[model samples]
Target: MTSTPSSTHFLTIKNTFISTKNHIHTSLNTPLHAPNSPIWTASEIAESVHGKLLKWGPPGTICTDTRALQPNTNQWFFAITGQHFDAHDFISPQLYGKGCVGVIGNRVCEGWDNGFVQVEGNGNVNTVDSLINMASYARNKRFNGVLVGVTGSVGKSTTKSMIALALESLGVNVFKSYGNWNNRVGVALSLIGMDRNVDIAVLEMGMSGKGEILELARMVRPEIRVVLNVGASHLENLGSLEEVAMAKSEIFREAKLGDICVFNADDPLVSTLPVPHGVRKVFFGRRMGCDVRLVAAETADGGLGVRVVLEKEKEMVKFVIPSPGLHLALDACAAAAVATLFGLSLAQVGKSFSKFVPVHMRSELQVARNGIKIVNDAYNANPLSTRAAIDLLQSIACDGNRVAILGDMLELGSIEIESHEKILSHCCDSNIDLVGLAGNRFLIAAKNMNLNRVKNIVHANDAKILAQKIVKRLKFNDVVLVKGSRAMQMEKVVDAIKAMSIHIPP
Candidate 1:
């Protein structure tokens, strides 16, 4: 998928399961670092955090998943703010007689005689800050590794996963984020959740504000930074496109002279950025100027067919991605670009691409019963990404009818309508056979479109209302494209379509 340079961001945390164990401490003692310790050093934890010590002797164990927050079994329950129900409320009641380490909040609580790590702070912000501090401290003590930060408006998560999986396949012990845990708390928590033996650390830095990316970047101090194409996204928060570019470019700003900044050569905004003093930069894309360029690409049923001819090198080899779209091709190029720096051969990198698959809900293809094709690009929405999705939909349209069920793209700020209108214009080009528009603002743009010229255009105020109508309207050989900003919850449309029980592609 195409990523914008604009501000909205997401993080990743791999499934690094921390082995839950019985209680480890009973009373306070000078903290000591252990090679296999999951808890941070006392000094390291104190250095980056500020919180009231509710109770700290020995945290039985750290419980990250809320549903799995079983403190009675021996674990420290940390409640820092109002973001969650007070951990103290459940601590005493749930583990009244249990051997659990309690990490309760500063708020009111009744039961607490011993085993409570209470912290007083400005509710949400301070508690999380300190918790993250603890996570960072744990990471420092835990892993002796290289930190790789991936950011951009799009494809950060997928790129991070591809590299991590490839590294893992090569027998490299790696620690990457799980899901979209790219935020401050997520990053901190992921660090705490990290396994001690990880040889490489991959973190996705998703940002919406000015210093957010910087915060993660500082924590990572990556040996290498990958800036996927920057486009317009989260414009509401970052304010302008330039600011979005600057925000993402902060990676280069923070990178040391010897560190490499991998960029998208096809992206004008990213490619044109004046490289800051000291940091080395390399470009990857379809452009001739790119250090690593896609010489040619073909298409096949199993995957996307590609023939990449690296510039200034004699290597020209064919590769096939498990996923479709030129976007995936670009992602492979970016992965190949970074893999080279990691001492991987071009052939080895090509082999890695051979096993790649689209992260779920990101242009993943599924065929419903009755031969209807569904392209699920529902993970996110942005002006550039939406356009790219539409283009992909258009290219995939064949004997089947092409349909686009869209919702409002969020965080576009003042230009939401114009952005929506631009996509509408693309639909008007006739690649789309039917158009279902949800959201009031989206409806306005649909109404303004040349509806009569298009074969079919329906405006639904909400997804369910529109989904019910489309369920009856969709026919055999129809290709439906469901896309929208995360706020729109457009995945509901994908679900509604799936609920129809059409023959699905395996």
Candidate 2:
């Protein structure tokens, strides 16, 4: 009988599943330690949940999401009580059977036979806390492979993807935390359901507080920790920009004797970290003293630039990164430096850099038939990345009227207003002729900057209104940059622009 490679190691298994008149097994040959697909014992599930909860609390019923839950569809889910919704509402009747475990819920939920846990107050708070603890627990077990933890005000996801790609290209069975799964809950999910086949797991850890990184660091115990340039993304929650740096640096706190620390040489905060002696330290950027330096950069026909850089062994080699922002260039350098320590050659590393693509809403490029250029960089925003985007927009040349469509950056604790003001000042300094800003903070900052007096500047409190207004104002060959935090949804503006007919430049 053919079995799954190993039921425990399969992220999603295929044809090895077997079904007979009397029995059904997802993997005919493999041992089923948990149970059938979409069903598990209440006790078994509680054991998993216990790993997160740290207490021997009885589990409630197990319910899989209807979308992913199907006959022979190999997955199950546990619902824990939180401050918000109760798991009781979503339970279906088909879950209870001969092999059925218990239902997971806060109180005695109907259509459930297995178990229930009584949460006294604020279920969501407890649920999230328990989940965080469980995530920490699961990651600490059998941590054999090197765990690379990467975080930055920006580029953490992209950098982690590059590390994973470079490693996988070298025949390493790499497991990477998917998308923006950098928070505590996301990290927990990655580790809990990790496939045993993963040779190296690249994790992205993001924090908005003083001790959050330490918590993640303790969980992963990374052998190689990469802290990308820390900037003021969540300044409000994090108190100050310096505090943000400290929080990001906490990734290095749990490094062992032989761990490696990778950092951006150009970012002063990241470069100045007091790394431990036995652990290796590597730096990458355009700075002269850095171990890796971008020797030359020339913007090509498209917004993307052909950049040449010097690595540890390679002196200078030109490569085309499909991005215009210098920040992205620095991210590529950082990824290269990281891959080098992982035993990848310069060619292998450099080749993977080209293969690296930007995630959506982070400086994505689009051109109209009539030659209007738009830089869509509205994924996530902080002051530093905003400035970087502005710099790229300002480089549109002596002829093109560089336009910046900006939105307010969220989660900047108390310094929100001042930070927005600073961004307005940077836009002015960059000589952007036309500026359109959205959200209350940006509107206030724009007014404070006296942008109303500047004939070219326009401020709108809402993003949709601003996008429509700016679409009408854009001219041919005008380079417009659409950027803000994801919450701002500045992509709508890019959409509005595309919706209009292009006006050809004379």
Candidate 3:
């Protein structure tokens, strides 16, 4: 797992545990933290959640899964009941033995007497609701730091990371959402873990349909809301680009007076969205009149050199983004715009890009032992992102053939077939020598493609078969790009090719 640059200290609380030997050990210390000391208190939790405490003591850390609990930490396990599995079934003596401080649920566990926080559910009260309520209350009460909420169809995580790094460069203590934890529960938990000492908090808000972003905005109530770009993501649920724009526009709904809302002015759909009154709207992109405009972008040192014009400053500054995608350069520009609002100079923002690390599996470049360059962007995909990846592949200096291994971009609704076919045409237009496709949608798209216009197209039933066929055809110095949606598991192809190269003579 990738971690931010910081010193993380885990507070330990003492708990008594019995060893396998029947002999009574007076003190068996288990790891736990006193929640009320600086973080949270039992009474505060009870008040915030409006729950009856069956057993009350000092509040400990909050947890949702037993597997994630630390050894001696006093953890309050919220037995979140779901359709597939109820956490109530996992509550037992073993959990208590493992230093569980308490359990919050709708029903009482039969054999547990340690500690219980029972939520008032009128027969079907969800513990998750209580969790969210508690988290929102904690965020509202605990911190007064600058809060930034990032949302978009693509690049939310990358842009969030960039903004955090830029703030950190200015010596601001920063807290951001971990990995892709951008959903409702994830945002709640992230807010709950927020430290009071930080100067700013950057949270990524992601959704699959309408109203989800609105709910997240209500929870964070961020003063700085960033909508990166509106794209084809979640079209299956949102129906169309207009609906997607509306869903993303919800980030601005909870913005108060004097809050800053950042948008991408280069995108026709995103630039046209109406901003609510009383909020400052700042746009970032290549277009004129944008608050942060890209003057020029070019390939530099295997990465991207971006010359940006900060309209507020009325000056042009150049920055070298260490990532090799035009999309990444644009994300850097967006991050720079946010950083400038926090009082960082354009020079400071440009210098901060040197420390930026591309998130794993998101256009991360790797060279195998066989000297083949691999672009691993298999984390997730849409038509827009796939085209960006292909553009990155085309820009690289490849000694051998340039190959694109694409898979189905799911959740496109009625346009799934059309989107896949469009991606094939894009590859044909690019400088790619061969295209390897996986998934049923890609197969359908391949059948519709004009073989005369674009030859050397291969289709496989699945990722494993696709990897098998591609590995046999791969040679030294081949530049291969593996990308698809999460369900496609396109990373397996990169793994397969690397494994094959290890056994072959370099």
Best by TM-score: 3
> Candidate 3, 501: how far from true, in Å?
3.4
lDDT of 2 at 214: 87
Task: For residues 1-506, write the lDDT of model 1, one tens digit per residue.
Answer: 22222111111111121222231221111112112225432223334354455444453455533345443455455564446444434545445445444554454356565554434355444466567667666655566666788888988877887777555544555666766678887777667766665666787888887888888877667767888978789888987888898888877676765566788888777876655576667678887656667777655553323334443256665767766566666777777776655555677777777877667788888876567778888878888888878877776636657898888888888888788888898987755878888788787666676452344877777887888877777766777889887778788888888778654355
1 versus 3: better TM-score goes to: 3
TM-score of 3: 0.87
Each candidate structure's TM-score, on Cα atoms with residue i matched to residue i, is 0.82, 0.79, 0.87
The top-ranked prediction according to lDDT is: 3
> What ranges in model 3 sit over 4 Å off?
1-38, 97-99, 303-312, 450-455, 502-506
Off by over 4 Å in 2: 1-44, 51-72, 80-88, 92-108, 113-125, 142-144, 275-277, 287-289, 313-316, 368-372, 396-401, 475-478, 501-506
What alpha-carbon RMSD in Å does predicted model 2 have with respect to the real structure?
9.3
Instruction: Let me know the TM-score candidate 1 reaches against the reference structure.
Output: 0.82
Error in Å for residue 26 of model 3: 37
The residue-by-residue lDDT of candidate 2 on 19-97, one tens digit each, is: 1122211211111231221223334444545522212323222332333333433333445545665555665556443
